[model samples]
Target: MTQAVTVRRDGDTFQARLFWWHAARLLDPGSPIIRVGFENGPKSFDDIWVEYDPKRSAQDQYGAPLRREHVQCKWHVSPDTYGYSHLIDPEFINANTRSLLQRARDAQLAYAPDGIGVRFKLLTNWRLDRADPLRQMIGTRSGAIRLERLYGSATDNSKAGAVRKAWRDHLGLDEEELRVLARTLAFGEATDTLDGLRDNLDVLFAYVGLRRIPRNESAFPYDDVVFQWMAQDRLEFDRKSFPAICDRDGLLGQGEGRRHVYGVKSFEHPIDRLEERCHQVLDLIPAFDERYIRSEADWGDALYPALRAFLLSAARDQSKLRLALDAHATLAFAAGSVLNIKSGRHVELEQRTTGERIWAADDFPPDVNWASLEAEVVELDPQRPDLAIAVSLTHDIAPDVRRYLSATVPTVGRLLMLTPSTGPGAQSVACGRHAFELAEAATRMVREARGSSPVAAVHLFVAAPNGFTFFLGQRQPVLGPVRLYEFDFEGGRDRSYTPSLTLPISTRTGDPV
Candidate 1:
């Protein structure tokens, strides 16, 4: 009995953490989730409830908008695996009177009679049985059973058909009724451990401007707070009330003024919940799909004009802009130039390579060790008017830049290579301050190298973090007319560097300077 009590307590903590995760998103004005509830929905799947605004509802794998999600969290002290057969077992689902399938059907009927916009989810720490036929039917990306697989092929003699027959017989339903229930049901494996859930919550807490759990602290204040709330029967929260509760609990962090998020996506997997996080989104995937530009004209005609217009409008709002870039390095630099240092906008870059960190110019003190640059100059043609600058902080891209310049741009007379003193690698740049100092040093190097010569334009190529590239662009005015270049990382388009946006965009005419 004592062991059972302890097990229940641990399980409650896990459920509380999951509740806090969805609940905290209510602080974001742009979040689609308008309300979150704990232990307040259908009794069987009532661990948590997340209600989305119908106008901005999140879509499922099949692209159907979801209005609400009823989640049931099952946590265990030891590793366990379950298969299709176990789902119908009363002991496995812990059903007193009705099985999980029956509860899910009832919940759908109550919430969404037509089954247009509701989901019943079972989130468990237990793994799916590796050898089970159920594993083959589940969609790897969706975590939901495939509709065709659930219905099975024509004969109904396949393994998936057998599992479907078992479930249908257990539920006492016809094929159509079974399809409706299965469509609304999703079974997902929770990958996070107890501590891992806390870590994820810390990230969300920071984003919503809430106090984070202090490092190395033995006591978990968040878990304690959830327990307190549970005792008081304060289980429901919405956009307005959630922040009030957080403040009353002393969970609010130092207030930063109005934050406006912007997303620049050029990839297939866009930023998740971008509409929830950003006030505006600039999608460049149409012009530059994945890694390669579809056409040479697309950069100047479509991508740059759209990006510049977006930044110009955002800067006029006079709010701190938080930029999340899932784009190529060149476009990242171009974005920086649009919202240049003179724009007087406090911009924060979301850096996510090693781990998630918000990098801002003033986040840390200047590191003197990171102030200097290792410079190498190569004179290709002294008579030519153009000079190429290769900044390699992430990796050595000088070789690739040189090859591209030699084959394509004969007008580029010289090439300048700039790297960190410690040499180039992923961890070369430490933080935002370090990146800012490096950008300053790089700008000064370009000025000294040009030295009263008739340098027509500076061709810029950078292999660095998106944050660093933005910082570099902020300092572009110090260098003369600068042209940015993008490389085909995916090798779909010639496997070479192509010129992108030319910086120092004219303010009066909105043209390249």
Candidate 2:
């Protein structure tokens, strides 16, 4: 729950914005939501209402009856001085209870249609500070001491309880009636402040379009995409405008396909296909830091054009790079592309064994190729027998576990154990380069045994960074389906290993297959 940070408190635009945010989630595609009235308009009820049908006009005499709702938006900021006594402050009581009752009454009389349902909703950004004794008095417990005192069952009342009395007098309701009204009042509270909300909005934004580099607050210099959308008028809190955007984008429920799938469930491999249909959004951090963030007045101008160009370039390469490869192919592609990007020219790719041409110097290359250029090609077996490649880039496996795997899994086929080369006095660290190297070595082994026999299977026993795992996926169109394993380490020692999900390797990526 985030209070909208982009607006001011005095003007109370946040209430409207809050309404906009909620309405977007509620309204169905093409549901008729009419702006019944604004603040202080005569013959109007609260904020807005949804008509039973959009096909029939509200003005039509024989049209369908309008099914509507009453929504009241309220914004409350905590008092500067903290005290239990502030809970009874006339201002707080007046804003929340008395005024709300009057509004609800007026709206009911003006708009409640016969035999049609009406929902009363109160949306607010209040904590209802628990320090207030008044809040405690409204506890859900039926036999509570606080409820008894408020209802006069317990008869000791001072000036502190007068706020409840005022509310009762204004609404002309008894204790039980007030309790029922309280239950009917749909209260939505935002516990999170604006800043925290903004951070979450960033993650949500990633699903829609952009991908940003992961970094600490100090390292992240640009304004967030949500804030930018707010500033540019792309995001609004109006009754008609908000729903229209949701309908256009198909964010109706769990979202339309990729907007919800890859964006929401990136952890799970796709069930129906090898990959998602969505394009990989450009990583904007590098360009923003290099060209705009610190440069005062010209930042926007510089950023906009640079972003446009980068997006265009990515779009150009998308079709060619859409194909997914196994660790081997991903390595060669990455090695060649990384070298090409660094040199500002294409790199020649050659087969290790025959020195046969693979990619010419002018050929377009993928990003992970830099490490592949320097990697050695290892032959698996001359007879080209079945093989199992166990890639461990993170750390050394326990001797006992290794021996078990050797005996349990058939050794008639070669077992190529791939690990990062450790340097003197330096602890082994897994990274993109190391991941690519392992894949490159595995690629050579696979190539040598291609026609002789099936790959048997490639099993990954990995303890690596998320970035490394992600890159490993990027390089896949492996010779066969790859299986990932999870190892449990208990008491700082290896305990057991369990098979995880199988990787969905796409051969040529047009759609997710």
Candidate 3:
């Protein structure tokens, strides 16, 4: 929950720049090489370090530029080295999902000059059932408007109409049915729940992305995201191949000679659940028969982009160079072309380390005494306001967490949390040994609402081989030999071994100290 940095109007467009935990590429290599983690919390935008040419003065392709713009790195973990667990708020996740999908749409043609855009708004997600004004404020339309005023896009109404129309035609649904679907879409709910087709569902038609394709290469804007959806699932035609849809149902998997099989379930491994569900539902759709067997995607492979961002962030903060190795990112960099910009030279990048690409490898900040960070436990909730009054020690909260927590409580501004690294091959000490109240709460809600195993998503958020993240509702109080709060998200465990122990290895190689 990040408050948009600020807003400034430029001509017809109200110009504003905001920072999000997006999986971006470094400017130097220009390719999908290194992950550019936009930092949040305590660290100032300029202060945030990006391990690049440092010498390469690249343009920050932000929407609107203003004097002294800002960025904050929210909670993060190293994705390359190890596996981790995180607690996220389900309500927030639901809202976040809608926002992400909508943003993905808005940014579809973000790179296109005067590109046509589509804005799917979140009119309401707030619970009037809650009594708090602050929470209400967070979930209000005014808040959404404020956010939009600062970050909204100028979507092309005509384009949205065309895409919506194309999708309906591809599905062979009449205008009346299309209107019904459109109404449900207006509510900002997951389209998967459009018809409550969750149980005993049948094969269906869908699109990998929007109906329109870029006329030229300049539309690098939508290419990355749209292609990603394609890579996630194979394309198929309905009787007539007039157009293509994402095919969320196993309809394609049931069709003979069809090349791609889209996903219906959320599980990450064995594809057993998906396999079973596809079989059960295929018969429901009269057109799809049992003989239709297309290749099933691993499904988990699609999350790699987001995982790259998490991995890079964790590596940088935790000081573990190895986690970088775990992500194909180094490979993306190593194999991708690099830009010298000056002489137009391309340099190949190689991985230098990876002492331990495991889940739970080492500790970070070997010098920072964990005992001091581990203090008495202090819990916070919507009911308690004076939790700040009981505060004694002021461990500096990392800049990123500070911003996110600031959105939670006023006290967050006053407290300094002892922070740690987000490297791989280790666990985040945040919720000591995993009974994270906030994380577990989110997991339960996700399981109940999604009717899918929370373990797959949870592992995706905390584990490697995929992108994983948790909400970690504003941190809780810490107590014991190792402060609970200190460990919460700190890369101490992973970074200590990687950073402190491996530094000498590089020095021994006689590389520049």
Please state every model's RMSD to the true fold in angstroms.
7.7, 19.0, 24.5
- Candidate 2, position 151, lDDT: 54
Candidate 3 on 1-513: residue-level lDDT in tens?
122222111100100011101111211122211222222212122112222222322211112211111221121111121100010122322343332223322232232123211122221112222332212212121111122221122332443344444544444555544333222111111111111221111111111112232234323222233233335552211212212222332113322221122121111111011221121111111111111112111112223233333333332343322211212211122111111112122111111111111111122223332222222222333333222211111223334333434453443212222222332222333222121222333334333422321211110111211111111211111110101121122231322111000000111232110
Window of ten residues with lowest summed lDDT in model 1:
267-276
Q: Across residues 1-513, which tens digit of lDDT does each residue of candidate 2 receive?
A: 244452343214443333332333223232244333234321213443333333422211112233443445544554322223432343543454435555554554454422124434444455444555454443221111233435543322653356455656676766655544433233334433444333433333343332333536543222332244445656333446654554554433332222211111111111111122223322222221211123322222443333234433543443233221212222223222222222233222221111111223233334442332122223434454445444544455534335545555443245555555441111232233444444455556555545455665665555443323444443446445555554544211245554443444222334221
Q: Report the alpha-carbon TM-score of model 1 versus the true structure.
A: 0.64
lDDT of 1: 0.78
Residue 500 lDDT (model 2): 40
Model 1, residue 123: distance off in Å is: 13
Better lDDT candidate (1, 2): 1
Q: What is candidate 1's lDDT per residue for 252-310, written digit by digit as tens?
A: 98544336678887652211335555677886765643366778777767787788888
Against the true structure, candidate 3 reaches a TM-score of 0.18
For each candidate, give its TM-score against the true structure: 0.64, 0.31, 0.18
Backbone clash numbers for all candidates listed: 0, 12, 62
